[model samples]
Target: ARPDVILPESSLLNLDGVQDAKLHPSLGGFQSLYDEGELAIVQNVGYPEQNFSHFRSTDIWMTGADTNELLATGWLGRYLNNQYPNYPAAYPNEDVPDPLAIELGYNLSVAFQGPVSGMGMVVGDPEWFYRLVNNIDAPVPDTQAGDKLRYVRLVTKQSQVYGEVIKNAASKITQQGGYPDTELGEQLKIVARLIAGGLQTRLYMVSLHGFDTHDSQVLNSDHTKGEHANLLATLGDAVRAFRSDLKGLQIEDRVVGATVSEFGRRIISNASLGTDHGAAAPMFIFGKHVEGGILGKNPVIPETPDVEDNLGWEYDFRSVYASLLSGWFCTDSSTLQETINKPHEILPIINPSVCGTTSSYENLYAAESWVRNYPNPVTDVTTIEFKGTGKPIRIDVINAQGQIVETIIRAKVGAGTHQITWDASRLTSGMYYLNYHNGAIHQSNALMKH
Candidate 1:
């Protein structure tokens, strides 16, 4: 939804013949990290049959279920369950004295709920957990329920071992300063401290809310000085500080952070100066070991846009998960299939050098299509000519940075030669790719606009 951060060269003048486009200026930290090769942008990340409902979409993302499927267990929960089958019954042993996953908040996300019991623990802090366990002073009834209550209290008290472990680890090192005072910053600071303190936790989850910007997304007087901008600034600053803290702790390469949203905003703004729920948005992944560069093509802003028009996705969100499982965690194909329930193409998000040996994989990104844009160096306009199979066809203008600057066409055409006029007068002078795709056939033709 933040085009300035993803597609910095996209022009509103070209789409609507009105306002000019520019970077939001609130994303300086992200820009700096990207320029320094610590961040990679994944474009048009979504799943098929995108349901716009926030609750449903969030469930789909958390549980890693298909749009029409219902899943009770989360993706990571399934993985952890598979990895540690003796969990809950035989945890906190000599080899596993710490929580497998930790969520730095009060309520644990559904993502950590295992098929049987929760695969992780959630706490605001070490003291918080201790106080919760100690504050249970209610009297129990003299019946079968009393026996159940006693057992539950005993189990709760036994879990306090985790609290002691967390306290010991956190006391090992004071956090390296530079984290923003924001909530996300504090949460990430705790994560860094825990990891640095020798906690064997493999997964940590933290969250930042208020992204449901239905109104007042931007200021009328200044488009970049409102709710969305403030959130972005918070995110950018907190993440930058977290990265610095990780580097200072010498754990930069051991951790990777990524952002996920339920859905993206529409391409068009409403009367309240905010965008509505839409499909397909960009995702950001950052770490020292990440292959820092843009992945997949940029989203295509359509010509003659309408309120109903939303960005189409290129890479599925499952693909990103698959990459992490394969590239970062080095999980086997059986694990991948069990986690995501399907095979998805693995992107080069993680550095291959770090992952010395990996299972054989496939690329599901695109196929070859026969298409060409005439007039190599067009100063004003160019003609995109291609043959389609009477199916749905899409043509996008992709810049060198892999951002889709403009969409030339997206429609069904007859099986014959078709030519569409693309006005590139408003586009910057640079090398671009005219990408055409119709189902299994996809291709990109180089176009130079002077």
Candidate 2:
């Protein structure tokens, strides 16, 4: 069977002030934010050995586990548990007066699943939980049944205490105006209020559904008016409003936000006029301190797209996670390795002027071996230098499609600092990756040539 060469009509077009990109019409707010130097996009973000199933892929992303590995705890959960070892024993104290994480929903997300239990609170309504706490009656009789009852009481009592803390924090500030009256907007509005109220929560999670557009993604008459468009509109408007509120409270510089999804849609459309599950997609990061620009080269579209084909990943998704941990939180290399459970390259997503460079990056690859290239965004030629033990070294230059375009070095190099002059004049101006491996030390880095 042959596939059709039909292309889906979209309102996506290049907008003013946005560099090297096209955006849907509903994403005007995001476009404006980018123009103001407060937003950046990382294209082709995905992991190796991607799973296509919704549940399994989502689980892999939530747990931050390799595709073949199964983890009981989540990425953030492990980090939080490590940071606050004695959590829930005597939490909400003066030293740590608020929850470690908060999800604006009724059920705790698996991303907060710790080894013992969920680490974050799921707050739907504080008053409801407060009333439930007050409704607890007299103590039960001294028996096995009483023991279970007491445990339940303790859990509810903890919830009540957290409810009080949330109430106090939320009462400290009112949200600024201009938030859309949509679900995402309301959820983000609450988050803004909590942050403004002086809640010291380090992480917050909120979701906007309806991205699983397998059928009728767009209207037959108008490609711009449909499920996907509505979702983008809600997202862009809410995020812009959230940013304005944060600026109003003068906490814009203190917070950063990024979007994630399990997978992207296939390049080819189906008979239902919708897209099926696909591969790598773009992820956006926005904040006052974000280095505003596109991170990687755009995904390459084939001459004739196939139904079973998918986009290749340029940047491993974990690299972005590692970058945020190191650049934003100033996490140590040891802790960063423990958190992600692997070594991935760190992209320059944060503005070094605001957050400063991480001293932990050199140590992230290995204690004995570390590599870096000079004159980034190079012009014709650049220097590639690295330190390593006496071992066979292999360095491959990879393109945006995850293809190894050149193998610059593949020979045994003695221990100590080494340098290689790479003439990139023959290579086109775009984002490329340097994959270096020597003995047990292996790492990846991004390179840009102007």
Q: Candidate 1 residues 5-98, lDDT tens each?
A: 2222432112111133223467767777776788888877876567889999999988888888999998899899888886789888998899
Give the C-alpha lDDT of model 1.
Answer: 0.76
Root-mean-square deviation of each candidate, in angstroms? 9.0, 8.2
- lDDT, candidate 2, 382-408, per-residue tens: 999976578788887766445667998
Worst 10 residues of 1 by lDDT: 11-20
Off by over 4 Å in 2: 1-10, 13-19, 125-158, 362-450
Model 2 residue 80 lDDT? 86
How many backbone clashes does every candidate have? 2, 0
